[model samples]
Target: MRRVALLAVAAPLLLVACSGDSDKGITVRAAQVATVSEIVDAPATVTARAMATVTSPADGRVASLLVKDGEGVNAGTVLAVVDSPSAQQRLAQARQAAAATSTGAVRIPRVNLAGTQAQTDGAAAAAFAQSQAAIAQIPDPAARARAQTQLAASRAQYAATQAQARDAVRQFDAGLAGLGTALRSLTAAQGVQAQAAVAAAQATVAALTLRSPIKGTVQLGGTSAGASGNLSDLLGSLPGGGAGAAGAAGAAGAAGGAGTPAPSAAGGAAGAATPSLITPGALVGQGTAVATIIDVSALGLQADVDETDILLVKPGVRAKVELDAVPGATYEAAVAAVDLSPTTSSRGGVSYHVRLTLGAGRDTAGAVVATPRPGMSAVAHLLVRTARDAVAVRASAVVRVGSRNAVWVVQGGTARQRYVTVGTQGEDLVAILAGVRAGERVVVTGAERVHAGQKL
Candidate 1:
């Protein structure tokens, strides 16, 4: 019984020894398992896709550029009109001349050179008659012999007459060929002139009526429409016309193939009330652009980065964009292009333009919900680091001395200082290269105070 009592007492003491120290100020928690990521931030700017300089076609006064910059336009829509009274008058005259000279108006067919050939034949005949008359004279005993000689001469003259007739026939043939060619050429020229006159008249009339060549928001400028206001509002409120309808349809159709038809005209108009091509009374000039209509159905982002960061960007690289205007929202984008040439800021600094195409991701959906503006500031994070299941520890927990990294690890009721190789680091963690293993206890607390083989 005494031996059993001694055994019981020894078991308690052994349990205490195995349990080590009691709970104290130091608290231990499991290291968080997470994938580490890093980002490089660069400043950027946004710009329009294209900018055009509108000019006038003819030398005329600034009759006015009806639309202001940033206005929308449509194809075949008249943007501006240049007042050219002289040009209009000239066109009218040309039209009249063309109508007079057109087919069925006045066409003349002259006799072919065959008639000229007939006159040459008559001349040849007269010369032959004179030769015969001369040969008939001359008769003496010596004259009689001479008369016989004269008769021979007349016969030779008759042969020459036959040769002349053949020459006349050849000349007539050539003259007829030339006449045919000339007639055809003249007819073609007259036809061209007639068509040109008609075209000139039509073009002159067209110049007077400036219409929208593209469907877009119109800005009143060069010439005012008697009222001044935001260009976008005016375009939205303008009446319907063929030009306007086409523009609206095009814009809506481009917004993803689902679009509503523009409102139709109600009152007196032929076939269909064509929407007004442009706002009525809007002033325009020769070749002056009146509107800048953009199809915002799909939107993308453009960024200007420093030359140093350009190399890191490539087409298809994944990126996240946070717009300054859209707080707490990020848009998913992909690298579309890396432009080597300078895109923005003409100043002495080196910069390149990078285009980011927004993708149909959650971030992009957020952008649509937030509706970021065109020029809004955005920060992009290009994913460059990728690693999986790497062992890591807080960088702060590992103290670097010279070329070696040291961390205190707990073992056998004591703290041990271990020198380790760190492969990578993060804001809160460092990858332990060779000195640590998963699920091992480390001195996260009291790390700075612990010494090698020190008792806890």
Candidate 2:
């Protein structure tokens, strides 16, 4: 019975070995001579070379919008007008104070004793002296009496004149003192304060008018208060004075004043020129962005490279850029910059920003291609290393054996373990420096199942 059981097990084992599924063979591929390149691919974005945001200098209502979105504008172009009543009032007060202080007489008064009062006093003294001398020379009682009376009259008149001269001198001195005080006041701290007020008022006035700081296309920006018809449609209607129709309604809303809702929040008509965020009567605070100007003539690509591959990228390295917007077209580019600092992704991976400059390329007929716009999605392939006509094999065909690398070569339905010295390992291919020749079949998968000298 034991012998019978052994025979039964051996018969089943023999049949199982002859079955089609019993053969565990490995897949093999021949090594080929081709160019292998080590490249790092990263997502990129097309961006403008320069961009600027125009902001409100102070809190105020937007009185007028001079440029619409997508409109071409030059540097210093008027973008919008802000109506700041408070600032205007402040400026008016400052100007009034300046004018009041600047319009007064600035000349210094001169005080001297050579005036009519001094002349009159001198003449009176001389006359009185002469009269006294004549009286003393007179003789006879009647004549002397008459002369005495005349002398008395002359003395009284001289006394009155002297009093008048003293009064005149006092008045002249008082006037000089007053003039000096006035001259000192003009050059004193009050004068400097007036000048400062005027300068501040001028600056406030300038702050009310927003202007484009760069030459480029304008993009309207601000906090949206309410929904209007299409935002773009409202901007388009500005050149046709459609905003005036909305202004009438806004004025009605403004009549409610302070506590009432903003007029812009009460949606306007279908064709009004009021901006989605800022309208004619809308209030904006200082430093609020009013518009954006982007210089689109020159564009570049911004890519984020993984931390592991960042060291392989450097300035002036050649790159190939493919844009999603312009499908099937590849452009030549060069690395312009790389951020030394790294940034962390949401998933905790580290990355570094790399900037590239796009170059103009020609087509097969040598025609210049169209330039890509800003904000387009792009992919950049940075060439790290390249080997021309190199003996290369799939990376999976090589396995790490202790410290060195080895591959399983299959010949005549048998496997042989061979050591390979690899120069550069790419994403899918590895360049072999030795121990592997072109057109040799190497086992790529299932190498663990086969040993050296194992038959397939």
Candidate 3:
């Protein structure tokens, strides 16, 4: 009887020890109402609002390097001058063509028809007869009538020519050697072509004198628009008509594409050569980079958000930015745009470009931060999802119960599985919508070790 009684007391003590040990291995927290946010991180780059690139309009040698690199310039300011022999030659050719075609008035000599009038009249009659026969063959009555009228007019013109010739011969017979008949003047099309060629040539020469298209600092290199091919401009400079060549490649996207219409500051330059290379007499091709003007009045950012998180991001979404150069500073920004086109990330993951307008920022000391220059690297944490004052639990507490999410709640020393409708998920907290309640204790640290009705 004494042995059995000692066993009974020991069993209760062992049960208390087991419960204490189980509780020691797990951590539980009372659920409370809190704000939960889902942040999507993205890689970003700073860029300028606009950039202007000045290019060599023609293949030529750098005649004069006007402004130094890094010098601020105004729009229309002459940055450099290129001496293109080809452009000068084209101008000269255009000028000479214009001079030759100065007057579109043309005259054909009228031969004396004193002895030839009879022959000319006979030939005219024969031609009219033959033409009339052909006109008769036209089945359409309206067409035949039109042809007959045209044939009669032609015959009348021939007779007029004979009369003019006869008159000229009489004048010659009267001893007036300079008296002769004049034919109709030529077309004015030649004149128009001449003017067009001259204007185009002049424009081409003017382009060689590179001017700043925008007010910005002059970089060593620039970008250009693609091949300039104008049919009228081309035809105007022919032996009598064709004139100048086309200009190619527009200034593109980082500062410079496939990249962006407004490039990042680092991307716009094709290549920057040393100041010496661009000195007088250096040769460059048509559309070659001569200089780039960066407009940094407004700053923006481009970030590549992963495809998985892109759906959560939209215009006007709030974000916080951090730059490597401006350490300890947090920049406030909002999504200005989200690109429809996707770009492949370095890890081969699909991502999209998201643009944001950087707003005011503060350093750790709470002072207003200065604007970051273009081409700076940055990271943005986008507040894509948020839940305000919702019942929430530690993220570790929520466990995947197959298709649904659930949390282990401690009730009267027993753990119970409460299936939840999860909402906004933050880094460390998860919003529980349906199953979980505020003030309820949930197993957080060791949720995986808990079973239904498990003692805590």
RMSD of each: 27.3, 27.9, 19.1
Residue 33 lDDT in candidate 1:
34
How much lDDT does candidate 2 score? 0.58
Q: In angstroms, give how far residue 325 of model 1 lies from its true place.
A: 3.0
Report the C-alpha lDDT of model 3 over 146-179, residue by residue, as the tens digit.
Answer: 5456555555555565566556556666776444
Q: At residue 156, give the lDDT of candidate 3.
A: 59
- Ranked by TM-score, the better of candidates 1 and 2 is 2
lDDT of each: 0.43, 0.58, 0.61
Could you arrange the candidates by lDDT from highest to lowest? 3, 2, 1
Candidate 2 Cα outliers beyond 4 Å, as residue runs: 1-22, 89-204, 222-283, 359-372, 410-416, 439-441
Over 4 Å off, model 1: 1-32, 41-77, 83-297, 304-313, 339-353, 359-370, 398-426, 430-435, 441-456
- Say which candidate scores most in lDDT: 3
Model 3, position 77: C-alpha lDDT score: 82
lDDT for model 3:
0.61
> How well does each candidate superpose onto the true structure, as a TM-score?
0.41, 0.56, 0.63
Name the regions of candidate 3 deviating beyond 4 angstroms: 1-25, 94-202, 222-276, 368-370
